[model samples]
Target: MSTFPTSLTCTSLSFAWPDGTAVFDDLQVAFGPGRTGLVGVNGSGKSTLLKLIAGELTPADGTVRVAVEVGYLPQNVTLDTALRVDEALGVAATRAALHAIEAGDATEEHFDVVGDDWDVEERTLATLGELGLGHIDLDRTVGEVSGGESVLLRLAALLLRRPDALLLDEPTNNLDLYARRRLYAAVEAWSGIMVVVSHDRELLDLVDQIADLHDGRITTYGGNFTAYEEALAVAQEAAERMVRVAESDVRRQKRELIESQTKQARTDRKGRQLAASGSHGKALMDAMRRRAEETAGRNKHLHEGRLDDARRRLSEAEETVRVDEEIRIDLPSTAVPYGRIVLTVEDLEIAYGTGASRALTIGGPERIALTGRNGAGKTTLLRTIAGDLPPVAGRAEVHVPMRFLPQRLDVLDDTLTVAENVARFAPRATNNVIRARLARFLFKGARADQRADTLSGGERFRASLAALMLADPAPQLLLLDEPTNNLDMASVRQLTAALASYEGALIVVSHDMPFLESLGITRRLHLEGGELKEIDREAVGYPS
Candidate 1:
């Protein structure tokens, strides 16, 4: 903890995109003295809120107040590749002053620059080691390390500063299993205020509380991810119960209205018959008929009012119930025989970011997970296997049809509609067929007409996945690279559901352990230092 209690408060914060899309309006929220895991669906302005609090974006209205110094690690961290490790840590000036003093140069300027902290170098090295960057040297350039290492290097810099508050947005995104554990440990060790926006389940489990951002408001839930989930489940159950009760009330109202109207109609018929037969005096009969009509009108109006009130209540109750739609994927055509050879690599020397290479041979409906340091070239190997890139030395041949979903999701044509993009892949399929399939992917009717470029991150992912899976030649071998990188928990669940229906061989390059476990990965392959090796469950942080 710091000398002062850390706090962040936002007052009547309002913000909008340049295109005039309002994200938050009159939002008031605060965070104080603890770890908060911020979570929300895609397009709910979770990232925007972080940016506003970090002062990266100016709010259209209102103010953000921080009680102390802060350090922020963005979702997509970019370090100057040419910068030295010490320089990136913001300690080069102090280190230089210390070195000067060590050389017996008794200068007042050096003393002032060094201040009272002379263990800066050792502290920097220690921070780096804690984050699994022990092999990295102080004078090493950022370019010499992998992308995952860059994220850690940036985090290490922040940790060394010892700011009163730390904000991390998706900090564990590209990290491998080993790196993710290191990050989790760091998160556990944090003693001051920290706010994290991430979809990684393990990282979220370490937070002291869960802050749910929805509809431009923040709802704080006490405890970690599991506790938040339990609370949410209870809330959902209550909401669902309300909906059921409302539905029953509406049914009862309709039934009562119909029954009352039927009884009134029968009484009016009998009274009219009596009047027509002249069973009473004309004035008496007329008065009786008038009374009957008035009574019937009153009953009808009362019943109608009761029915309307019931309907209004039902509508209000329904509005309170949340609806989370799921996708339905059934791709029987993509299935391969149990004994079929999906792919073969004979001495395949694929580039692994370094001068060396890796090789592999996979068959049947195998579910493989590729894990390693970020720049160990998992994406390169996937692309090479997908035939997007040529091999460095040997051959990687796919015995069955294959489709690759890259990190960029570039398989889609932004200019075309979702239906049209799927049509492009399956030219023989009719519009109706494509649409029916797209509906399973949750692009129904007008949504299928939406252009690929206009899709949200989750929507784009689903669209891309649909096109690849629903191609003319159904893919028997599917390659997915970081499929859940930026997806929300809902979208991740959607992906899991879709994969459940896929009967083909799967090769996924992801650092997400929960997701990988959900996929029932048959073999875990760790790609590192130009070698491909199979690892056990414990090696991937999930032990059976």
Candidate 2:
């Protein structure tokens, strides 16, 4: 095996926006050889931390230490316009050559200075071949390639350079199951330090360690996500047990206090009655008074102590309650009836241009998920159903009310405000009702009036959903295409929850495995060659 570098480390590393709103603080973690998974809710700074480690961004506080060279794959990448696959790889190879020359292994004069650099061409082609793209059309423009292919091309470029450590952010987002498996196998075989930022829980099992980021802090676990989740469950249960014990203690203390107060009242009453009878009664009253005072003093002291202890116990219970709150989930209401069949595709055929046969087809009130490679006709099938594109062959039918929320959310006018978008969809809804609905979706007050273009990806998703929900009868069948693409963890969870309970039939095309799982998807339509086939849930694994 090749000698590996020491692990990557961070010391008191912190980051925040320029405005000083803290996102993370006093964080420390060490990652070494073997696969390490970075897991966290959205907006927990997972992506930001990865960027900092890759030196793509500077930390606001402390330091990021790299024990060896690092190879980074960003979560989102835009390949240069009009560049051919081979040409793009050529550029990557040239940079690698420069790095070699800078290290004193080669001289610039040894090769031709300008275009068509022979050594760089050879090196780039070899790297591309290793990535299973050796037979691809080298001259094909990147603009014509699918998103998944673009991601692979970027990785191929990085692989050509061969850094010792790798930092991948959502590396499987754009990939299909086949490509994902291939990448997972490759990473498992590599003997180097790797830190992967991913939401796919199934992917987490491939890791040797797991780190969970929540509320600006990180907790490291010795096992993968499944183990971490099991540990978390155990901890939550233990905390709840402790809370119950403390609550019981408080109730017992209160009961004791009440009994002691009652006994004191009786002693005082008896002493008063004895004093009312004179002489012998007076003597009795004096003794009774002394005894009552002694009892009262003891009771007061004991009750005070118990109160103090109870307060302390209550404080501890509050902490446990806070931990429980971290796991809460919120899904929106699609609030509609089973209604009638919304979409029907009979002999529906989808293909790329004239590339052979149909990718998929279905009919009835089917809650189908179309999944395949980037170039495969997943989205095409959805578009054909949504009327965005004409089906290449076969027939399609639409019945009940329907709405389309494309990944880009093109349904809303960019120049319009959130309220305007909602109003447009529900023409009968009053202005006040429109605003109220937007607020429920988290676009409140002034945010509801902001231009569609100004909203963040999550905000836009919610806005789009609000508009869809406002449809008088509600969309009986909803078509979503990669709806969770750029959403933060919180938003993804919220969206997933809403979809899980949505009453209408849904036909979704997504690459997000975790999102699909959260929605309780039990079946999938695996599109390949030119047909639709049902696959068991276990047969198609998605990241958690």
Candidate 3:
């Protein structure tokens, strides 16, 4: 932790996609020294804002101002496989110069390159070690590392620069449990102006504050994620109450308007009767009728205005109540009978480069949590079970219809609409049937018509999940690999809700402990040393 006067400020920042989708409009936000956890539902522009601040994308209008140097770690990190660890860390040139000087070739240029950083190699190794990359050699190429390690390597590069302001977008998306712990520790130790966009609750719990980006605005809340949740709970409660009051007011106004209309109709009939009865002079009767008509019109206009106001209030109140849609679907077709063999892998070996293998059996509707370190072939095993890969040694037998949701979610066709994608999976299903089910997944009407490429991360996940769940014959054995990797809290909740209704045997490979526990896992298995070892939740280093 360093006491540096650093800040990140956005002034009237506005941005829109090329397709004319407006993300932010004249948004103004400022982040000073301290860790700020940026959270919002997917598609709320959290990542877009981070990109704008990082100067990766130019805002359509306004400006982003930073008081100090900045470092950014994007959500998807790609590294040149041929580049060495030292090159990726941006210290290769300096290290070369230092080596040259050490070799007694003390050229002026070499001295200039090595100036004041004679221990650059040591610092680089130390930083990598701090990020749990100590075993990685500086001379080793990036192709030798795992995806999670690559992310950490990128972060390590940024850490070596020691920027005053830092921004991280979903840094824990690909990290294993151990790597996530290291990242949490790093976030805890940071004291500069830091903003992290993530949906990992445990990671967010380490932040000094929470910045909720919603509806093109950022609202800052003091304390960690727990405190922010508490505040949100209170706000939602109040908003619900307001909605109720508004509903009552609207009902009352509607009743009054009806009563006024009825009274006016009665008055009109009475006036017509009086004029027809000739109880007064013709001219006097006509004048009285005119006066009555004017009064009736004015009263009608007043009542209508009141009713409109009440309706407007109700709409505003409803807007304040967050619409966290839940997936509601019945999956009785996916049910597996008790003692039924769902999946069996005997001496199975994945075809990937990782020499990992597994031997296991899943029965009934058992919920299994697959846990392992990064590069341990968890994904490879899942792919093998999904029939995407042939086993190098043995066979995997699936007794029932199965579906696998991969981390990349590339199962969808970007050129097709969401409904079309679902139809591709369940070809027999009529458009009406597909739409009816997609509505439960929250892709109603026009949303279902939206192209797969146009959906946000959360929306795409929902569409993919819908396609799997609605597939023909149903998925009696469901496999999800890192399902919650890029999902926001709301999407995760929706996923949990959808899974609750599923009566199938499930094998979920994930590092998200809380999500796994919420599924009521019947067994926890650790994939290590080419074997599946059953363990308890606590044994896997997860908080019980």
Candidate 4:
């Protein structure tokens, strides 16, 4: 900590990719001592900006200034499996030094290590418990927990360090509903300067304000996520009105220019007739002809200039009406009959550590939401249902055609183009058919030819969904696991709209309550304590 107030600011920041593509140019933004949510559509450079501020990614120009130390939790967290919990938390040395002193091997070196804060163990336990990690022992190995737990562990480490400023990117991606609640509580209790980049509605609602990064520009709005959206909706409405007015002006100007040009043509013909008839002296006729020619030229230039001005105004007005394109998934072939049995589970136990003994069945287009705590085997169950993993016992089956979109989105082949990836799922389909089908996912034209490795987070998700939706058999039963994890707000809306057109059975595993609520889920399943049962929406702490 320093005498100055905790702050993080950037001046004239500029950055570009190795491929000569620009992401930011001369961006100026300042963040003071308060919680701020950073939001924008995918590829808008929210994560890149955080990396620049945290010194992880250096800017090509300008500078990042911070009054005190900053702690950053990246979107993807990887820890050494060989390390112990204490070592991962950066407290191994201090804890070891304390143990030695307690064993009567007290030395000046030990004292230096312990410092004045001797209750490190108590603090560590409290922090872990706060993040729903109380069951984890200090000596536990990093490999012993689930992916979501590892994220919370890293967050706990940062919390105990108590840095002046904290930066979190997609912190709740892998967390379960319960774990997400814990993370939300931790965010609410944070008193220092913090900036979070996340699509989790609950977590974003805890922010003091929102900093929206759009088209390489930062726009600040007061209050939480809902407030920011309300404000944006109002602004977008006003911009649309301006666009209408400007368009009308452009049409009026074009009509006036055309009429004026026609009138001038008629007058020019009359002047030519008078000159040809020699009604006056040759000098007067020649002078009049020159005067008429100059006036016509002047009038033409004036009308053209007016039309150009009107067009320019229209263009400017259109630029102000910013909106993200939506993915269109109209799978008429995927529709299921009313009496069709889409999926069935009979006393099935996933190959993972957890076990479920309850029977389940999904008929017609019933949308099911699967939720549970971390390490509760949600992913395992989905994998088993998809036939990717063998069930420990009983049977898990899908009666109709199905496609699974895993949380990692690894189904895509990186070297192949978007159209090619979808083609892989439908090898018999022609390139023209694949590309035409891909347009529904918002990957039209050259975008459909882009390699999978080159796509942004949202684009990758959409491409994956496209591949699944356009498969040869046509997915009649779509199984999505954490589909909204890496998606931005706009992409989530696109996915929701796309799902509305699915016309088939769906079993989606996600912790995003708002996203689930919007899907018109017919039932909710909770898997925990070696049992799977139907739970009411209100029982899960959300409305229908």
Candidate 5:
């Protein structure tokens, strides 16, 4: 740990959702100066804790103490499109004052506004440049920047504040490779109490330590994400070994208890036979019978106590084992014949307002990865193919049943439950059938009844995925846009597992290289400079 002073401290912090979902109860944690990666499975309250610390949500009990200024960047960032870049950066007034003073109209109020930030404009430009927004002019409207750039701009605003403590939630969710690199650099250069909640492995690797939030508790591990994983592997191995030992002990104790009972029964039978045969006087036989009865009761109690102790040990051991379930389903109907044409783009022009055009044909069950820099119209192309957007020119056609999983995952109705969402896609399927299929997605029983709006980032993604995959007419061609955007690592693995079972043609537009590689992408396409180009994996900047 760094020698810097503590910037944030939570003392017995407690919080719950309006629906009475308890997230944290008497949770306590402290962060000193240095970068800390906060990680956990989806819905494990990583984001919730950050919100609590950031004061975005109020706690029902306990206290959160922040000794310094705090800056927070939430998962989704929205800015007023009409606002100028400087205004969005929170430096518009100071910049204006400085300019007025330079122009010899130095009013006292302007002097007060300018204060000591006379170089605010230069500092703003420098910060923007550091975040790969050097091309963005201070006078440009927020509408001019792309979504990814908008996120960076928000972060730039936070940096400009120079808060002593920073909390970032999934900051790299929509960032492309180049933008991600810039964010990574900013993280590396930070020197303060920085707590980041993200599943980006590359970004997590730069942290000074890792904080794992699970089961309403936080466990700190010294070192980066890789080191934390190694340590966790060791702990899990030990826990599993203990569970095996405990199971064996329970079996042994059970056998011993049974043997003791059998021995007592045999002794009782022998005593009864002696007593019936009149081998001893009546008084002596009665006394011996009482003694035997007492001994049997004592032995039974001892054996029972031992058995209970063994079971307790087994239960404790089992609790130590982690439960990270993966989604496993077989969608054989989604398969396409080897020579069948699945989709064709005949000189199609996307509605990206950039006149980007592409002509392509996808056959069989090929998996295609669409990649490019931000603002390259990958999402627009996917939308056109999904029939949600009309092509500006030419024609895009799908020869088979198709489904689209958009980046926002807005397909599900907020008022509907997970099962209901699935049923919406598979209108003819019975509730029982939908429930069974949803169970494979890990939404068994009451989980299937959860409202779409109530789901965490990961759960929502799984729900959206389940709906698409469990449709009545199986989708032979699936179009996905940034499917892994806000998912945690475990959820990402679950998605990969689910896709492995999908034998359909796929066209995924994403910045996640690992996920594309996991899908065994048969082809790569890049949208660049207002045109589609077939490229090798290296051209897409993915490792071989």
Candidate 6:
């Protein structure tokens, strides 16, 4: 490892929206050399903060200082379609210059540029090869590759630069289980300071620290996600208890003040009686009565001040606890009676040529997880079940109301408002009902009126799920393709919690093993070379 000054500092940094609504204010933190896992729910400004660190977006207030060069791998990127893998790594002009210099016919300018560093190109190629793409054609255009491969290609290029720090955002989202494991190994071997924003618990366990973001604030922990969660749970419960005690104290103080007022009123009535009786007696009684009233008033004010102080402290505690607490909504699925043989696939074959092998077969609620390397037919088999794409030659039938959430959230209408998309997809529900359901999903008030395209990745995912779940006739079968790709940790937890209680059949095509295991997956279907094999949990990542 190189002796690099890797540090990031932010002081009094604030950011707000166009309407002057602050997302965060006076936030300060210093990130040193370590693997950090960033956690937050939807609309919590996790992604926005990452963007600030990457220098893609500037803070509205204060400043951020970084002393080292940073290499950022964005969650989604646009690549030039015509560029080949090798040329894209160094750009076309750089490759051309290098080639000329290698031919020994270069001017002083070219010689100076390529002097002694021409071999860096070989190192770049070696890095790509280490990422398990050694056999890939370097001259192949990026457009011809799968989206997963394209993502890996960009990461390979970024890693070859070998900057002082690395920022990866959801890098393992769309890969299969094998590829995800491979990525985990790659990250483990990385020697630079790294900050990763992801929902994968398994990945978070490898981090040196975990930073949780909520309500525009950040809290740092020294351990993994599991430790952070445990601490948060305990802290939330303690705060709740403290709040209850504070409320009780306020009520007690109010009662005492009321009793003291009643006593003072009785004393004044007696003094008035004495005043009506005589002259000298009236003067003495007036002095006593005034003293009593003054004393009571002072006591009342003191008690009121004490009550206010208690309330302020309690509110602060509540605010601290709110950051750790989650708002859970129970989505009640309609009771769809399980029919005999809801889905059946026999001798399913997905191959490019006529003489290809079989891929998959199913008969019931198997809770299948399609696993393989990057070019495998995991998505193709799921599409065949959804009837969007036909199998090469196989009998696949799904009888229930099957709902599919594709790799991209294409089910949502971009131009329509969130409420409008819900109404369009779930037409049987009335406007009021649809809005109420959306509100439960945290898309209430002005947010429901925002266009779907304007929402963040987490919000869009929640809206799509709301539409599907709120439909009058809920689907009995769910087919998800990389469903947790862009969701933050909290949102993923919310989903996993809801789906755990779901009585419907789920067929998930995801590399997230922890998520699948949490759902109590009964079997795993491994696909490779157009062949499907049913395996136990041990082969996937766990064992009975």
Clashes (candidate 1): 0
TM-score of 1: 0.86
For all candidates in order, the CA lDDT equals 0.85, 0.71, 0.87, 0.87, 0.88, 0.74
Better of 1 and 5 by lDDT: 5
lDDT of 3 by residue, 447-524 (tens): 788888767766778889889988998899999988887788877877887788789999998888789878988888
Quick one: best TM-score, which candidate? Answer: 5
lDDT of 4 at 36: 97
Pairs in clash, predicted candidate 4: none
**Prediction-by-prediction clash tally:** 0, 6, 0, 0, 0, 0
Look at candidate 1 and tell me the lDDT of residue 483: 91
On TM-score, who's better, 1 or 4? Answer: 4
Off by over 4 Å in 6: 1-22, 25-32, 58-67, 77-82, 91-115, 143-146, 222-245, 265-280, 323-333, 346-366, 537-544
TM-score of model 6 (CA atoms): 0.84
Model 3 bad stretches (over 4 Å):
1-7, 261-291, 325-332, 351-358, 413-420, 429-436, 444-455, 536-544
Regions of model 1 farther than 4 Å from truth: 1-6, 104-112, 328-332, 338-340, 352-359, 373-377, 387-390, 408-460, 463-467, 470-474, 535-544
Candidate 2 wrongly placed segments (more than 4 Å) = 1-8, 17-22, 56-62, 65-68, 90-130, 275-298, 321-341, 344-364, 387-399, 407-467, 470-473, 483-500, 510-544
440-516 per-residue lDDT for model 2 (tens digits): 67666876877886554445667887888776767767888887765655567767766766766788888776677
By summed lDDT, the worst window of 10 consecutive residues in model 5 runs over 535-544
Ranking by TM-score: 5, 4, 3, 1, 6, 2
RMSD of 6: 3.9
Overall local distance difference test of candidate 4: 0.87
| Per-residue lDDT of candidate 5, residues 454-490 (tens digit) | 7777778889989998887889999998888778887
How well is each residue in 1-544 modelled by candidate 4, as lDDT tens digits?
4334537889999997654558899999988877899998877788888888888889999989977788999887899988999999988888999999999987999999999759999999999999989999999999888789999999998988989889999999889867888999999998888899999888899999999998899999999999999999999999999999999998998998899889989988998898788788999988888888888889889989988999999999999998776676777588899879988899887764687658888899889998888887888889899998999898988999899999888899999889989999989989998888899888899778788876766778889988988887988999999999888877788789878888989999988888998998988887787788788766645321
Instruction: Show the lowest summed lDDT stretch of 10 residues, model 4.
Output: 535-544
**On residues 11-42, what C-alpha lDDT tens digit does candidate 1 reach at each position?**
99999865466789999888888899999886
Q: Give stretches of model 4 more than 4 Å off.
A: 1-7, 17-21, 60-62, 272-279, 415-420, 444-454, 536-544
TM-score preference between candidates 1 and 3, better one: 3
